[model samples]
Target: MRQDKNDHTNYSEVAQLRQQIESEYRAACEGLHGLAMRARHDFIQARMQRVEEYYQELSSIVGPEAAITTVIKINDAFAGTQRKQEPQP
Candidate 1:
């Protein structure tokens, strides 16, 4: 029934990071209303498929090809963060 002190702290940090990612994604998606429906659908499907890739795909909902690339960077950065957190062999 006991958790390590560092475990609780690490869990909190991970929760905060997730909140930041979602908030930033929402802010980025605000300019993407017209694309929302298709995005919502794609998001669901993507979630059903690969959860990790969801953020990048959601970021790209903005139809403009150029903007999509720029937006995807946000997701990419977070993705990289997760990758770096993994232990290397």
Candidate 2:
């Protein structure tokens, strides 16, 4: 049916938007870490604001549980990378 086709298209669009937002959120977090390490307080605050906005947008699209899951996954990945880069004893 035509309605079924439209529904599928809408679902696809939502999926794409969710993915784009998630990627932006990941990039913002990565940049925020660098800013914090460099002691760029002003830039870090601004970046943190942007990161919160990204979370709100993602939550609107995918619900809070899914949005938080995405955040947790990204954070875990970053933590793992940081651990690997730390100097060994």
Candidate 3:
């Protein structure tokens, strides 16, 4: 049916948008971490606000569980990056 096709198209578009938002969320988290490391307090606060906004938007699109999972993944990835940057004793 035409309506079915339209629904599929809409779903595909939404999925694409969700992917874009997830990418942005990951980047934002990394940026926030970098700002903290550099002691940029004002920029860190602004970036933190942006990160929270991204989380809320992600939650609205994919529900709380999926959003939290994404956050966990991002945090784990960031942690790995942090370890790589640390000076070895």
Top candidate on TM-score is: 2
The global C-alpha lDDT for each of the candidates, from Candidate 1 onward, is 0.49, 0.64, 0.64
Order the numbered candidates by TM-score, best leading: 2, 3, 1
lDDT of 1 by residue, 1-89 (tens): 35687667756654554455555555444323334434555554443344334434434443346334543566686556656756799
**How well does model 1 score by local distance difference test?**
0.49
The residue pairs that clash in candidate 3, if any, are: none
What are the models' TM-scores?
Answer: 0.36, 0.60, 0.59
lDDT of 2: 0.64
Q: Write the per-residue lDDT of candidate 2 for residues 1-89, one digit (tens) a residue.
A: 99999778757755665566556545555664554456456655765566567667767767888877876676677667767766799
- Model 3 has an lDDT value of 0.64
Question: In what order do the candidates fall by lDDT, top score first?
Answer: 2, 3, 1
Superposed model 1: Cα runs more than 4 Å off = 1-3, 34-89
